[model samples]
Target: MTPYTPPTQDQLLAISVNAGIEELTQSEKFAHAESDLVEAIVEGVGQFAAGEFAPLNRIGDLEGAKLENGVVRLPDGFKEAYDAYVEQGWNAIASPEEFGGQGLPFTLSCNVLENLGAANMAFNLLPMLSVGAIEALEHHGSKDQQTKYLPDLVSGKWSGTMNLTEPAAGSDVGALRSTAVPIEEGEHAGKYKIAGQKIYITWGEHELAENIIHLVLARLPDAPKGSRGISLFLVPKYHVNDDGSLGNRNDLRCVSLEHKLGINASPTCVMSYGDNDECIGELVGQENRGLLAMFTMMNNARINVGNQGAHIAERATQQALYYAMDRVQSARAGAPDKTPVAIIEHPDVRRMILRMKALTEGVRALLYYCAGQVDRGTIGDGDAKNRAEILVPLVKAWGTDTGVEVTGIGIQIHGGMGFVEETGAAQHWRDSRIAPIYEGTNGIQAADLVTRKLGIEGGEAMIALFDEIARDAAEQPTLLALAKDCAHIVRWMRDEASLDDRLAGSVPFCTMAAVAVAGWQLLKQDKAVSAGAAPALAESKPVSVRFFLDHIVPEAHGLKASAIAGADLLYTLPSDKLVAG
Candidate 1:
């Protein structure tokens, strides 16, 4: 077994920037997030990872979570750690300043979240939900509503949940059956009584905080059918008074918690509203526009899910590297028979390890770059905003899909040990599985990319993205050739390719776009590296950027070809031929 040496800070920075991460910090819109701010966030995240969060990960999994008397109880030390998290004001990173938040860039907030996810995913979910609620409220909530609820949520004195999925409506919010009836002029005149069941609510019921604010979607009594009737609401577990203190428990109650395959520490609950005739909800935005309002939160949440995937990949890679270095195996081909070599010495093992490292770092770069885009879109000038909007779907879809693959490789690198639950490798694999499935699944994300984002502003935004990629690629001949190939493929896939044909190769089309986008981002980093940027951060830029372009970018070719191959083979297969009689 060989001693393990952590990658240097400079090396990480170089690889990250080469991956297009530092651009997030340097962008003019994010100028406020100076080096000192980044350092502070990094330091805080590092401390949380090392001291509070990482140590309790195994404990949380081992004990799991329990539902007793309608309340979810976390494993030992979970509450204390959560409190410590709040005490550090980690939850307020992205919240507005008026709401007792730091109002920092999402890029910085995302960096902190990545570390937290890497440390303990279950623990991180509570605050993640709260942030989502905050976004929805900030964007669409009435001024009165925001003033009343935003402070506690931002301060982490309370938590939040999004209630969308039900037994009948998981992916299709339009199929939702929840009802919201306006109250007669009485004690709750301005409110509506919500009656419905929402399933799979993360952090649905927990003892982690004093209250839970639920952002629910329900149809009004006189509303039209389908999604047109749907509306967003703020339903709390406990009502608050004019003074902002907690009041009586609301009508929402957790019937029970789900026993899940993974993320066992984060309570997934079945919530029952209006069971006792007391679930009062405040309408958000206009009636029948709930889904639109929810999109604000969902979009942000989708990106966060991508971050989850990236974080898990990073952790899994670190674990695999550690195991590879320590696990003694057969001697290398050239080594003496008497001496055993570390598994990392095996050519195949090294290859797997390198793939894991490359994928993890590459996805991290993508996630950070996406976060930077988000920051720019929110704070930058008009041009930056346009670019950021164009990149959203690409970031959401590609980051998550790649994350799953990277984590899977992490598991494979562990071999037999990977399958065993005790090794914790399998847990990462299981945890990552859900990212692509939820948050507007990768297929949906791809459809959004091609159908919406590509054509945004008459395709100008996508054109801009391509121009940037081309400009960056011109600096390196190898990458330029690859970029040209990708551009050619994208054009063909969009214009020449048939929808029915592409639908058969839907997965491949998505994969192709992901590959091209990743290559483009890496090329951007390569350009940054050549410009003699931060030395420490530019170190890994050349090698990683080249590795991705040479080895990974070629995948776009296969995907593009498959996408153009037509759907006849898939759709033509008779129903009888597809299944055994």
Candidate 2:
């Protein structure tokens, strides 16, 4: 098997350049940083990921996490690995300095996330979720809440979990039955007793941190119906005392751990809160406004999910490439020799490898670029903020879908051996599967893109994005025609298509947009190559871009056609008839 290697300096630089990081660094808001600083950080993170985290990937898959009694015990070495991660100060690399963070750009942080995620996804999720919690608290938490929680959460001493799912609620968060009732009298009069059960909670219970901080979504006594009645709360596993010491345990416990198809090392818990009516939780932002604050955390998580997609794809690609080169098979089509040759020499194997390579690099380019927009948005760039908002769904949906496709291809490249668990190829597929379902299902993401994002600011963001795509195609021959097709689709959604039609096409539109953005990023790479700056291992960039243009670009056009076709055909059949065998 081929050994996993960290991304090189040139690859990092090329990605950064394509992501517009250098341009952002020159702006007044980001002028404090330099390209060299980011490069160094990427190199450092790569080393840490390759050494401390990569070795744990298979170990985590094999050992997995176990639930014994009521406690969730991590697989062996997980605790030590997590400790090493925290001790290295990686948890605060992108957090604000006021909260004891390094205050670095999220673009750089995303690079770190990609490396760590590729190394060991289950382990990487711990700190990744914490970072999202920190963002939520920093943006919406009260001053007192910030002082008490930000430091520990930012420093990774306390891990965090987002509790938005329930067996009854799932994606329809408004259907949640969790309740938070205010205590009118007591030492904690301002707090509320939270009573509810949440399932599919990732890292809901873990031993890696001093405490597990849960950002829960529940309804108050006087709250309205549906989502409008929901509120956000901070419920810690172990209560904090007046002096910052640990208090009695909260009334919450992990009732059970889910047995899953992948990411077995990460504990997915079914948590019961306030079983004894003692689960006290403090309001995060305002009463009945929990969804607003929780959206912050969820939005952050969506981007990371995209990164996870890219990460898993990269890992699968490495494994597949290695196997293809090393696994000797039948002789080549035109070879004179009768001796068997490596599978990599075969045309079909080469096509599969190219497909994997193109999708992996393309998605990585899209995700990093999305992160860069987030950085600009953080700096108060309204246009960039709008761009980021619209791109979030596409990144999350397309990236994960690509991950699944690429990983499946990886399995196929390995032939029957890939189906066996021992080769580790199948695990990538299992791990990648969850990303599409994470944050929100890809179907939901597509719906959001068509409904909420396109109509924002009078469609100004969508308009600007499409305009940029058109302009981008002028220099890249592959995109020139697709860009024109994208423009017509945008118009169709805006004027020709009804709301139902838009919804029907939303998934395709989002997929189309993702491919377009990826093509744009790859075009930047093509330009970089043309300019005489290239990586030592970048011989594949040109070919990968070409493969994407030839094989993937037409799929975008087909999706556009489907989107334009509307939902009429989908509803033609009666519901009962559709279900008939």
Per lDDT, the best of the predicted structures is: 2
Using all chains and alpha carbons, the TM-scores for the candidates as numbered come to: 0.92, 0.97
Output the number of the TM-score-best candidate.
2
- The runs of at least 3 residues in candidate 1 whose Cα sits more than 4 Å from the true structure, single-residue gaps closed, are 1-31, 336-338, 475-482, 493-498, 524-541
TM-score of 1: 0.92
**Tens digit of per-residue lDDT, candidate 1, span 372-456:** 6676577545666666565566666777777678778877878898888788888777777777777788888776766666566
Q: What are the lDDT scores of the predictions, listed in order?
A: 0.75, 0.86
Q: What's the TM for model 2?
A: 0.97
* Candidate 1 clashing pairs, residues 3+ apart or interchain: 13-537, 14-537, 501-567
C-alpha lDDT (0 to 100) for residue 94 of candidate 2: 82
